[model samples]
Target: MHTELDFAFRRDGETVRSGGLVYATVSAEGRAAIALPARLVEMLGEVRSIRPSR
Candidate 1:
């Protein structure tokens, strides 16, 4: 499975976002709580997937 982590820079009226990719063995655990590999983090930067609030 895969997850897309985006970084949204804070702004007064506009949103700026950047994306990074990460992987997982399963999606059942949900992307929020998944732990990525340290090597991957070092190589690809930090990954944080965000979902819209319900």
Candidate 2:
């Protein structure tokens, strides 16, 4: 399963929003958090999600 993260950048009364994706895997121990590359812009209001997709 994966979780979707969203983020936004605002500057000079302008806003640009983007999304980041994270992944999870179930193993014998428990759910493991997977690390992925996320794309982020300047003036981040909140860290929702920031990842590049192929």
Candidate 3:
């Protein structure tokens, strides 16, 4: 089976903004970062959740 995963980062001391949907490859080792916002580091602390496509 195949699944779609998404990642979003929220930095500390800053408003947690939606980083938007990201395309990742799912495998036994887990999902890998294929493409994501460059601002991920800015919102590393404010990351609310990594919602996966159901």
Candidate 4:
């Protein structure tokens, strides 16, 4: 299922800001974490594709 997730920006391992994302998957379960803004979750209906930004 797809859902908006909240998170915070982090300079180190600790979370300094709140930011995350709930991406939709084809499989029932998977191992991976997607980071995104909660406000933009709705904009992404389904996780069509993912690529490394850097």
lDDT by residue (tens digit), candidate 1, 1-54 = 344555566578566664444455444655555565567667766544554532
TM-score of 4: 0.24
Q: Candidate 2, after superposition: displacement of residue 35 in Å? A: 16
Which is the better candidate, 3 or 4, if ranked by TM-score?
4
lDDT of 4 by residue, 1-54 (tens): 455444456686775566466555443355654444556665655644332342
Query: Would you list the C-alpha lDDT of every candidate in the order shown?
Result: 0.54, 0.48, 0.45, 0.52
- Which of the numbered candidates is closest to the native, going by highest TM-score? 2
Query: Once model 3 is optimally superposed onto the true structure by TM-score, how far is the C-alpha of residue 37 displaced, in angstroms?
Result: 26
What TM-score does each of the candidates earn?
0.28, 0.33, 0.23, 0.24
Best by lDDT: 1
Order of candidate numbers by lDDT, starting with the best:
1, 4, 2, 3
lDDT winner between 1 and 3, please give it: 1
Between candidates 3 and 4, name the one with more favorable lDDT: 4
Tens-digit per-residue lDDT, 1-43, candidate 2? 4445566577886766654544444545676644332432223
- For all predictions, the C-alpha RMSD in Å is 7.6, 9.7, 10.4, 10.0
